[model samples]
Target: MNNLKREFDASTVAMMRQAMNEVVADRRFLICQSVTPLEVAEHILEQAASGERDLDRLKISVFEKLSDAA
Candidate 1:
């Protein structure tokens, strides 16, 4: 039982470390862009929440806005 607990703990720690690495990598990408990382992340979350992640939908929306502006 103690051994199993240790294994689980080790697995959890490794998973957390990998997740941290991914976040750091994402931060690096975010830093290169014009928008802040937090804003980008929030937009991603909002898109997921709204189920509006389709690329075609985003493209059409942008095009519509541009046409309306013209």
Candidate 2:
């Protein structure tokens, strides 16, 4: 049970890291260094929490959030 939980946690972290990298690699996002990578990661996590696993949707949502912030 403990091993399963650990595995799940590790996978979740890896998924988030991949998502964050995708967000950072986006051309629109790259032009906005003021937003910070961590902030974009948080946005991605937030969308994931809401059951949004679609990568394109996550990217669009993150971009919308950044635009609103700007």
Candidate 3:
């Protein structure tokens, strides 16, 4: 039983580390994109102005969906 618990804990830790690495890689890729953050922010603001409600709320919802997939 102790061995099983140890193995499960190790596996969970490894998965968490891999997820962290993937997030870092994704951020790097986004930063490398030609589009700047200001441009994206402006777009989001436009979207909000067009009756999209709170822009930050939408962003959080989208990110949560993506995180679930990961």
Give one clash count per candidate, in the order shown.
0, 0, 0
lDDT over C-alpha atoms for residue 20 of model 2: 80
Scored by Cα lDDT, where does model 3 land?
0.42
Put down candidate 2 lDDT per residue, 16-39, tens digits, no spaces. 677788878888787876798888
Model 1 clashing residue pairs (backbone):
none
Off by over 4 Å in 2: 1-15
lDDT of 1 at 15: 41
The TM-scores of all predictions, comma-separated, are 0.30, 0.66, 0.34
TM-score of 2: 0.66
Q: Encode model 3's per-residue lDDT on 1-70: one tens digit a residue.
A: 1122222245444543444344334664254445444544444444344444543454553344344434
TM-score, candidate 1, is 0.30
Best by TM-score: 2
- Give the alpha-carbon lDDT of every model: 0.40, 0.70, 0.42
**Which one is best on lDDT?**
2
The Cα RMSD in angstroms, rounded to one decimal, for candidate 2 relative to the true structure is 5.8
Compared with the true structure, what per-residue lDDT tens digits does model 1 show for residues 1-70?
A: 1122222245444543443344436534434444443543444334334445454453344333334434
